[model samples]
Target: MKRIALGVQYDGAPWNGYQKQLDRHTVQDQLEIALARFARVDVATTCAGRTDTGVHALEQVVHFDTELTRDTQSWVRGVNTFLPDSIAVRWASEVAQAPAHDPHLEFHARFSARARTYHYVLYNHPVRSPLLAGKAGWTFRPLDVERMRAGAAHLIGQHDFTAFRSSQCQAKSPVKDMQSIRIERSGDAIVFTLRANAFLHHMVRNLVGSLIYVGNGRQRPEWIGELLRARDRHEAAPTFMPDGLYLAKIDYDPKWGLPQEAGSLLPWFSL
Candidate 1:
């Protein structure tokens, strides 16, 4: 059997989430169905991250093993033929699995990924745009971008993120290495960029929600530091809606044996 890695993108509006559900639409269910149809066998897939319902992905990584010997091009076209319009297999390639370096890692892949990046978009305007309704979180009140950035700055680096984690989170530990978090304004919208080794459930949204309070003058920017120190969920703001979030990209080490042209396969929005 050959192990293959797929780069997938999907419109999360119609699905329950990334994982397969017995009674609902899911990205994994659709992809597995498509893969079974094309390969004529059961295909089990493992993703780098499981995005919640209404959360989109620009370059979600997944791996599966297949006995079929088709080339990368055929895997792309064959799977796309069976997939729904909202989901697409952007790229496919044979992958060489690396030796496991950390048995405690929660993710399934054997490769050592460098980082995972996520982006959140908030529409801060008087009126909502019909076109971006489900694509961007709508915040009618004006936000102080500078204050939000200041709050975000406190979240960077290694920290215990229990305050930002979801109640349903299954992560074994609350400690995470957050590389960076930045909040910036683009036109009438607020965009947040977050990069981390891994994230707890609703971590990004919770952080964003807390920063929103700071931006609106309801909370001081330094309060974020206090919240981090507290490490309690109740001390943080509510988890924001998932509609504005996107799994932007995952970076892997060069030694993972990925294709030389893999960089070219990145989603346009990630660039």
Candidate 2:
């Protein structure tokens, strides 16, 4: 059997999440069902990240070992036959497994990943746009981007992000290396792009919620650093909605040869 890696993109609005559940509409369930139908065998897939319900992904890397052999292009088009309009297999490549005795092979859809990127989109308007209701989060109060930037600056680099982590998070460590965070405006939409070694559950949304507080002058920018030092979840803002969150991209080593660009896979994002 050969291990096959797949690049997946999906709209999370229609499904519960990436993980499969009994009697639930989920991305993994749909994808596996389609793969089983096409390959005529069971297909258990492992992903780089598990997004929350209503949280979309631009380039989610997943892997599954199968005895069936098919070319890259065929894998993309064939499995899509059983998938819904919300999900599609973008690209496929065969991952080379390490020799049993070599003990150096470290490639995995989740473990092998070096970093993950997320984008949170917010529409700063008094009246919410019906067109972007489920596509983006809406904020009625005017947001000061500079204030948000100041708050975000304190979050960069290595730190214990316990204040921003979700109560349901199961990550072993609260310490994470936040590589970069850039908040910019595209038209009326305020976009936040963050890259981290790994994120705790609801980390991005929680951080965004607190930043929104700073942006609207409800909280001072210094409150971010204070919260970080506190390492208490209660000190941070409430977790924002998942509607605006997107798993924009994932970073893997060159040996894996994964796709680099996020492209226009999702409806709202251009990154």
Candidate 3:
């Protein structure tokens, strides 16, 4: 048996979320259906991160074990032929088997991942953007990028992120290593990028909401620290929209040699 890894990208506006559901249109269901069709058998997949509804992905990594051997290019082309226009298989590669479940595999898509990075695109115009609706989050309030960056400082490094997670979060631990959080502006858009070991449900959106509050001077920069210590979700800002969130990148050990930057989050302003 050969283990295969695939790089996936999708616009989440038309689907429920990444996970498969009985009656819902979802990324997982779409991909698995495509895979099962191409491989002529049932195929199960595992991903680095599971995004929520309307949360797009530029670089999502997934792995599955397959008995049939097809070349990488064929895998990409064949899978895409069955996927909806909103989703695409960007790249594919044979990987070390991660069969810990059977005590014989080498890589687990969700387990072998090291870090994930996200980019949130916010349109900070006094007027809403018609072209960007459902593609980017818009706020009429003018945001101060400097203040947003200042607020993001408290969220860097390891800390309990309970206050930033959704009520639906299922992660056992609230403590996560937040590698970086940065805010920058290009034209009328404010972009926030965060890298972390892992994330809880709605964590990125919740954090961005709080930072947006600080950006608009509604809260002090130091308020982020207080929210962390509070460890209460209600103390944080309301969860932001799903449109602006993108799973930009996923990190793995160099040994895997997975393709890098297969699906780019850039051309960001165009969206």
The number of the candidate with the highest lDDT is 3
Could you tell me how far off, in angstroms, the CA of residue 218 lies in candidate 2 after the best superposition? 0.4
The CA lDDT at 14 in model 3 is: 93
- Deviation (Å) of 43 in candidate 1: 0.4
Query: Comparing candidate 2 with candidate 3, which one achieves the higher TM-score?
Result: 2
Model 3 over residues 1-271: C-alpha lDDT tens digits? Answer: 9989999999999999999999749999999999999999999999998999999999889999988978999999999999999999999989886455774348777988889999998998999988998889999988888988888999889999999988888999989999998787888988888999999999999999999999899999999999999999999899999998999999888898888683335695643
- Pairing residues by index, what is the TM-score of model 3? 0.95
Candidate 1: list runs displaced more than 4 Å: 97-111, 257-271
Output the lDDT of residue 157, model 1.
Answer: 90
Instruction: Tell me the spans in candidate 3 whose CA falls farther than 4 Å from its real position.
Output: 98-105, 262-264
TM-score of decoy 1: 0.91
Best model number under TM-score: 2
Candidate 1 at residue 123, lDDT?
83
Q: How close is candidate 2 to the true structure, as a TM-score?
A: 0.96
Which window of 10 residues has the lowest lDDT sum in candidate 1? 260-269
TM per candidate comes to 0.91, 0.96, 0.95
Tens digits of lDDT, candidate 1, 86-120 = 99998887876444784433223424467788888
- Please identify model 2 stretches exceeding 4 Å from their true place: 263-271
* Alpha carbon lDDT at 117, candidate 1: 87
